[model samples]
Target: MSALPRHVSPARLPEVRWLRSSYSTGANNCVETARPSAGPWAGLVAVRDSKDPAGPALLFSPASWTRFADRIDRL
Candidate 1:
């Protein structure tokens, strides 16, 4: 696996294009995801709390993310 920061401040990843689930409502109670478009962070996914757009974000490798989503789907 490629080395990646375990966590990063959202403000430091300004190039990320954050997205929330379509099922999310106006309460802003959901997690958001974004892919780093360029630089070392590219190809990995960044996830953050929708209610805390400027807060910390978790980083995940693409394969790791796919496995996580797959497990969630199976549940």
Candidate 2:
């Protein structure tokens, strides 16, 4: 359980396949998510602004993502 990096350059995670929620409108103004398929980032979730594809990504564990979503759902 080492501390995960808070930010990563999107270029450094080329293998990560970013996806946006289906709920996102055609304006493409939503956030995107990626699950690194290889390397040390494998199995962790990556999030970045869709408007800035090359921007830094925020990493989150599966459990942490679920909790955050749950909290949002309750709001």
- In model 1, pairs of residues that clash are none
- Model 2 lDDT per residue over 1-75, tens place: 999999999888986778999999989799999999888888988999998998899999999988987998799
Please estimate how well model 2 matches the true structure, expressed as its whole-model Cα lDDT.
Answer: 0.90
Model 1: what TM-score? 0.85
Weakest 10 consecutive residues, lDDT, candidate 1? 1-10
Instruction: State residue 10's C-alpha deviation in candidate 1, in Å.
Output: 1.2
The parts of candidate 1 lying over 4 Å away from their true place are none
Q: What is the lDDT for 73 in model 1? A: 76
RMSD of 1: 1.5
Q: Looking at candidate 2, what is the lDDT of residue 60? A: 95
Q: How does each model score on TM-score?
A: 0.85, 0.93
Off by over 4 Å in 2: none
